[model samples]
Target chain A: MSKVKKNVWWLVFSLLFLLVLTVAISDQYYLLVSFLFLIGTMVPLYSRFEKKKIQSREIVFLAVLGAIAAASRVLFFAIPSVQPMTFVVIVSGMVLGSEGGFMIGATGALVSNMFLGQGPWTPWQMFSWSMIGLIAGLLKDSALLKNMRSRLLFGFVMGFLFGWVINLWSVIAYIHPLSWLAFIQAYIASFYFDLAHALSNVFFLWLFSSSWIKVMRRFQKKYGLLD
Target chain B: MHTVLNDVHPITSFCYYIGVMILSMMFLHPVFLIGELFLFILYNICQHNGAKMKQMFKGAWFFIGVIVIVNPLLNHQGTHHLFYIGRNPITLEAIIYGGLLALSFCCLMFIFLSYNLVITSHKFLYLFSRISPQLALLTMITMRFVPLFIRRLTTIKAIQKTRGIQMDSGNIKTRARNGMHLVQILLVCSLEEALQTADSMEARGYGVKKRSSYLRYHMEKRDIFSLILGAIILGICIYGKLKGFGDLQIYPSLGSFGLKGIEDVMLLILTLLFTGYPLILEGREWLWWRWQK
Candidate 1:
């Protein structure tokens, strides 16, 4: 119970930290603030993960899946910003549950970027991937997610969301004194890439959704992991 | 593995990574960023021995080149009128800012490349284990899995080729579908093994007690020296930034990047030296090697 309480406070503290960060980003400390905001989001997840006495195999499982998620990018290396990472994340969430999804997605982005090159986009990628996983996990049993078409549609939408999430760094850190019009223009320019990412995701999920979900679900039950 | 970088302790390398990351973002001025970029290019070339540097350029040249051209087009705010492009007006400030952006990104990209070279997966995991053992272990798993999965994917593709389900041939749709089918087979085949993996964990003491990492890095004198240097420079940069010395205000009108006073010059020099530490060290090492020969 105390562990859970400690986790909850971590949530509150991170939120407060984020609030302070937003104010700082608007002021002269934008660079520092931007960094802290990234750390703030990640800390809570770490604290929560620590609270649970998770076993080694579960950790290994999450790591393997995360690695798979990172390697998934290599398959789509030919295409600009198109990959099945998002699809895999959704399946992990739907079958293995929320934390499982979050771990794989966040870890995937974090480690892959370690190889491809880490930048200002690191924090945003971590946050966005984990959030996508968390949302999928929360709605794992929902009828919307249970519906095949809706799940595929969700993956498609999330693909665009991932692109937008990356673009946020440019919005806050790069563009000085924030102009909405320029922000919109940046989005407009990257629309094609985002569209390709979204469409490719829809294709992946449409074809392999059942098998992927079955694999994840069967593993979850047989091993009694992340229940 | 150029000069002293490879031999530097992992902790020092990690500190260097952190310091470089923050400094690149904090110092928005072009002069500082350009110098930093130059150092990175030099350091990268030194580390990779010129061969991989060409590949890095091949991959990154397009985006870096685009930044210099695109930023001026997208952002048109400055007093110094450079020229007219079509109907839109271009300004020196926008161009300069664009150049700074490009240079800073170059510095960042190079920093990470060096980071990958310096801090291996074992080092990264070592650091992670101290902070949060669970996450560190997970990262270890991830690091291991990436190479394993890639190898497995290739083998699966090879086997599937024997069965006549083509992977590389045919149209994009057919090729993509074939790839997905191969991935599906891989996933299902691995599911049973995943259970065994979990079973093995249960047999071994997984969450039995508080986990820890295998302590590999022992802090030496050089490690401590690097740590002190890293902290000092990071502190100075942060202090200078907060005091408005390194601030490049460009919202309403562009601020002067020119060294107005000795203090400004000192601040600039401080930042330049910190960022250029690798460049200076590598230069000295190269000269030393030549002299010895």
Candidate 2:
């Protein structure tokens, strides 16, 4: 087979291996193992295949960003304000591109939850934050999202969207006595946190918009990425 | 932290989760809820992780507020009048009932928090590595890609804005249209990434042979003991629930029975212990570390 086909088969096989690994562990272990493998193996694979050049400095920066994202979640519990982590994840995406952004978001949840404790929600948290990173990466190269207002808006929408999507998971995984109504109630109850998160995103965007642009420009120039 | 307790066996933890879930759904015991809350608080204090406890409370405040506001308005059935608000009559029973509901929620949260402490993603994957590779792979990829997708969307939005497209200060319809445009971009990018991943995995021969894990979780005697203890607690709780120990009664006369005296308290404590085991273990570990130091 050609090199491309061989690569495709390898990718398919690895994914299958991941599935087997997930089943081997019990539920609690399943989430922990899956997350580690994703960060440890799948991420590097993507980086290698894409031939992405990540400097040591970039890795450190992403790790620190992950730490801050995790810290912000802990802070969210105390302040009862907007979600600073969502904005942080978005910013990480803006600066680091898709894979870096993803690692930051996923790792942030993984590490932070260690402190706060875990549950079924950990996977959901990982999924939600990762989605935020993915969205940011996709928009990194768009023509229309380069302005300050648009970035701020994107951040705001993400805040709300993040809440909505996670609530969808809660509706499915959490067995509420009220059934369907429980989902609605959970969504409604979560509105304030979502609003706080959305507002925080707006603030962060306003506070750091220019610096972000400069950083993105420097990253693109330095690495010739997402061109 | 004797690693034995700090690190609960995955099977034991999973069983505990199922037990708590079953209790929440069927039993609806006020004692169980209250006991769970007390244990969670005690465990939090013991861990000295004030920061995490604070975060859990803070993150949950909005939801608590919403429940406080909506429960009375929607529930509407109760006796023993408390007061009158507008045209609505607030009852003593509804308030007490709402409090119970909130407690129940906190119990669930505590269970989840404990689970998080004991279980890591790596262990989760290890347990399931041999069962079904396809599902495991899909799950792993999904977890891996979600954040990547979100990150890409953010950058794409920024790039679009730089090209002179304004997304803010628009009508709802306009904002939504812009949002859809971003989503479309993400969908396309993700598809490409998925294909690339597929190619990479195929080349590596990922599923061509049996896979071996880098990290191994050995099930020792403690693991068996923990599992047995978890089973006993779960069995008791199930037996109690089946015997109608804590069933809620709501009808012509609003009252509940089945949870009374020592058995009630014991059941409550057990439920809380099961839910908060991780936190308790973490707390014990911290204490032991402090002593050793």
Candidate 3:
């Protein structure tokens, strides 16, 4: 009981820390604040996985699924910003729980950037993709995400959100004395790529998400994974 | 791998890269950032003999060009009006701000290129494994699987090409659908095999005790020295930035570009040391080799 209380306090503290970091992004220390925000949110999630008594099957499954997501990014490189990584992460969240979903999204970003190139954008990409998975998993049992229509809608909105959040690294760090005009201009500049990403996400989720979820659910049941 | 920077502990090198990256963002003046850009580019050349540097430039120039070209057009808040493209007034201060943005980004790009070269995957995983062994193990397995999955993807694509689903032979929509189909197949097959791999790991008693690293990197004397030097230089840089030395205020009005004080000169020297840390280390090694010859 005391341990549970301790864990609750930790959770509250981290959430408050994340809120503070998010507010602090508008301060002069843009890069540092965003980096702290990513670390603050990600470390708690990752540490929870560490503290748990996870099965080998769970770890291997998450790794293989994340690799699949990363490889598909490389495979679909011919298309510009039209990868199915978001679809895979969302589907994984629906099948597995939030923890499982967060692992896949985080590893997907880290590993794909391994093959692509690592830059200042890596942490932002990791944060954005992981949030997609976390939110999807959190809302998995909800009636809003119960049907196919809303799920695809979630994917579409997440696509734009991913682009917008990723663009923050540049807009926050590089844009001087940030104003709404410059901020809107940066978003406007990325509109074409973001639209393509959103459309591709919808397309993949609409056509293949059901089967993918079924396949993952079957594996989870067979292996008694992430239970 | 045997170079001076890579020879130091990964934590030292990691701290070095982080220091430079934060400095790049902090120093928002054109002259300071451009100096950083040149130092990092020279460091890249020293790191990889100009091959990776070329690739870095190829990938970076587009975004750099975009920002430099776009900032002036969008930001019309500055007072020194250069001219009017249509009714929009582009200012000299805005142009300088754009160039500063581009230079900082270019510095970041070069810094990352050197980072990847210096801190290889084994060291990266090792560093993180100390923090959280589970996440590090997961990352290792995922990194190992990426190349294997890419290879399996090729095989699956070839096999599927014998069937009706071919990415190249389709229209845009069809091609994307076919590509996703290929990925779905890869997913189903790999998820099954991954369970077997997991069983194999359990059979081998994977989590019976604390995880031990195969590639061990303990901090040595050189690492300590480098870390201390890095902290000192970083301290001076941040101290100087807090005093409003390295960064230029260019939003409401442009700050003077000339170094107007002794503290400014000191800050410039410290900034040089901060950016050129790795280059100096590697250059001294080269000179030592020549002296021995």
Candidate 4:
């Protein structure tokens, strides 16, 4: 098979393996931890073989990412009213592309949980935050940030969507009521935190996005990582 | 240091850890809390494995802090007065309850740390292989890679700092962007590592039928007894729970200790035994080693 075909096959196999393993475990904590490790290991591998530049700086970048991600949890505790992780996901997506963004967001949760300790709630948190990074990276690639208005608008929408998605997990794990009212209550409770994230995203895009793109381009040139 | 930590079977230790975790989640029984605290103190002071105990406690402090902060917030109601902030009231009952929860969490962590000390990953793999080969494989792989991912993350961060990336104090946006930059790099690195691991696993014929595990543990008479006792304790706890012996209630009267009657005492004893089985095994091993000395 061609290299592309080989990578794709590997991805498919690994993902299937993960799905089967998740189902088999039946314990959400084990499944989440297993997934985090699997993804943490797999994401880097995918990046290396994607005919990307293979930057030497990538390792350093990831470590810093992990620390920041870990720190975000502490920040959440410090300021329980805001969700800093959402902002982290968006920024990661813009810099690393979708796959990279997803890995960091997910793995960051895993690392945070190590200190926070594991529980049934981790898998949902991992998936929810990861989707944020993945979506941000995808949106960034699509030129949603071309203008200030569009960038801010996208940020606001993404922030609310992120909140809504995570709230879905809360509904599943807790709130056995599972009614529309329960959903709305969960959403409303999350709104303030989500609003913080959304405003932060817009501000982030306005302030450092151009510089971020420039840095990525420079890093790519210097280290020949991901074209 | 080595002898006291080396006696318990990994599976027994794992069971003990899981039992404690489940109990911590299900009920905040004060007896169990007290029992666990006493056990931790005993293990720390008397186990003859001072270094191991220190490490366990050091690692535990952060979790303790988390429990302290989160438990109060989650369980908002309690009777005894402490103070009140606006609508949210902090009660003495809540503080005591939170403290118990923290103790329970520490007990779970203690069990896990003890397991790590007594049961090497290789031993854990061997024990699991007998029951489920795929799960055994996955467990081993996860244990192996989690640390690697952490190490790699650290390396990535150091490298970024050297690259003159200003990661420190900025506006929320700048900080977030910096964080994203680091995450992007980490992801790329992780993907590379995963590919390498996959290649290695494939080369080694990991998923092949009839994989062999190096078994080092034999089921001795003591092991059998311990296992039997564990089964009985687990059975009784389940039976008692089903019978509504310790069904936690946080309502009107804040339901006075569920385990009030004689049957409740029996359930508490069984639960404590179940939760502390590993420590018991370890204690036995420590005694044996001391006698030999």
Candidate with the greatest lDDT versus the true structure:
3
Ranking by DockQ: 3, 1, 4, 2
Per-residue C-alpha lDDT of model 4 across residues B130-161, encoded as one tens digit per residue = 65443344334434445565566567778888
User: TM-score of every model?
Assistant: 0.88, 0.53, 0.91, 0.53
Candidates ranked, most accurate by TM-score first: 3, 1, 2, 4
> Could you list the chain B TM-scores for each candidate?
0.84, 0.71, 0.89, 0.63
Candidate 4 stretches greater than 4 Å from native:
A1-105, A111-124, A131-227, B1-10, B44-228, B247-259
Model 1 chain A weakest 10-residue run by lDDT: A170-179
Checking candidate 3 for backbone clashes, the offending pairs are none
- Residue B261 C-alpha lDDT in model 2: 64
**Ten residues in a row with the worst lDDT in model 4 chain A?**
A169-178
Tens-digit lDDT string for candidate 3 (A1-227): 79856985886787677668766664566556667767877887887888988888888999988988888887677778899899889988887878788999999999998888787788888888888988889898997678989888898899999999998888877676677887788899899999999999999999998888888888889988886
Give Cα distance to truth, residue A72, candidate 4, Å: 9.7
Q: Each model's C-alpha lDDT?
A: 0.76, 0.61, 0.84, 0.59
Scored against the native two-chain complex, candidate 1 gets a DockQ of: 0.55
lDDT of 3 at A174: 67
* Candidate numbers, best lDDT first, in rank order: 3, 1, 2, 4
Which regions of candidate 3 are displaced past 4 Å? Answer: A1-27, B49-52, B73-79, B84-89, B249-255
